[model samples]
Target: MLKGKPKYKAIRILEGCGFHAQMGLEVLEQRSLINTSPNGYLDMHDHIEEMGRNIACRLHPNEPNKRRRLCDKEEIEEVLVNDLGTKATRIMNLKNPSIHPATIIEKLRKMKALELLSVYDADRVSQNWVFDEDVQYFPDTLRSLHWTGYPASSLPKTFQANDLVNLEMTRSCISQLWEDGDRKVE
Candidate 1:
């Protein structure tokens, strides 16, 4: 058993390790751990199941067999809006190996308190996926959006480039940024 005072506000569960989800939850609930490192063993799967709604996960890369564990839109909404309540912020789906593009879009659309969102897929090619809703649903608090393989032909009518500090959308199908004649080039 590990001993010593818990000084870290965040923890990382190394891949293939046998860290029990309940134990991690106990430490988080009792010790006030507020964050979890990205691309590690402790992912959204653990978060949703272990009562980690208030704790912000920096990234949520898909598991090797992600299709079986993928949370539907309702579950994602429940975790972010109902469970996390006002504490939900950053949501990262970067490097997800098998998640459908629409699923990622739906997740983003439902999350309102997001400050950083990463839906980058390093392995996939552009699929020209269209979001059912407009991007305007994205919170004004959002500052970073890193979505690789974005398939839309243009950003939603509500997107304002001024609000974003870091924007990376490689392999996107955007032919134009906005419909209005005013285009801001930096």
Candidate 2:
């Protein structure tokens, strides 16, 4: 689904979900399904790449909630604020996603199939974008989460993090990862 993304990064994300990336990548290479670029990124033919991305979306172009990837800004915002997500939405990439602080967790709980979530804080200044309510739950289905300016002090313990692999929070307010008596130490 990631068209021009670095291969290593995709492998790392997949590895978190118990996928044998190295083995699978090698097989793809052997079958000429993909190749390694000079920069070590995945290289594929144009038709092949186009076909791969379309297989999941060709059946539901009119339905944003049923698409495998959500990139439309308006639709992305709608899902965040309205909780109109479905299992088909596995990847969501958005810039400056704005969800009311109080409703953040409630909105997240509805995205049960989210595997990769990348939220860019391009507009909002890097500050404490936290909420009044302490978070009680975070999506356990995430394999990769890249959120700039993460607001919470500690990760919700209720977040199982069973499939979590890559967690990137730039200039976040997090002083601790989880509250294990270490939160207030510093």
Candidate 3:
């Protein structure tokens, strides 16, 4: 009922509402798909139903009961097979709080959706995982990253390696090096 340029405020409120509604739609769509009759007995309807329940729980308005459910192997397989398609393989690479790489890869390969490559690291879960010199399939975006736990092998390969040459080889090395440089100037 307020007046004078409430367009921005109205837009914000409407956008927020739309976002939640969109999420609910996705949940409903997934639910409908899960309820659809499977092609065969091995169609994993039980697993799909569980995943749909989890999704519904997450999108529920009850904040106290909205705790995100960690997906298991069966749930991951069902979602990958029935929901995400090729994007499922990419998402499989993500570090799930509760799921296994073998489980994901097994289903993906069985579905002929992804090729299991021995070249890739299976246990690579953390965002801080190290890369070796032989790593060939790394993303180009990773090259310019400034993460705290930079790989020791890659350190010498970066522009910042020159800083190591300035380091002194002793206890209180940094302070001692500064003092030494000051004395040399005087």
Per-model TM-score, in order, reads 0.47, 0.71, 0.19
Local accuracy of candidate 2 as per-residue lDDT tens digits, 1-186: 444558888789878767898899889999998888888787889888767757756777777777878766677777667667777778877766665433544566667888887776655535655554444456778888876666667666556676777888787667777767333211
lDDT of each: 0.46, 0.70, 0.28
Best by TM-score: 2
| Collision pairs in model 3 | none
* Number of the candidate with higher lDDT, 1 or 3: 1
lDDT of 3 at 142: 17
Q: Write the per-residue lDDT of candidate 3 for residues 72-146, one digit (tens) a residue.
A: 444444553443333222112222223333333223332222211111222332333333323212221111111
> How do the residues 1-186 of candidate 1 rate in per-residue lDDT, one tens digit apiece?
011212131122211123454566567646544333343222234444444432222133322111212223443444433333232433444454365665555445544555555555656656766666553345555555667776676665555555565566788666676545546433
Query: Candidate 2: minimum summed lDDT over ten consecutive residues — where?
Result: 177-186
Sorted by lDDT (best first), the order is 2, 1, 3
Worst 10 residues of 1 by lDDT: 1-10
Clash pairs, candidate 1, are none
**To one decimal, what is the Cα RMSD in angstroms of model 3 from the true structure?**
19.6
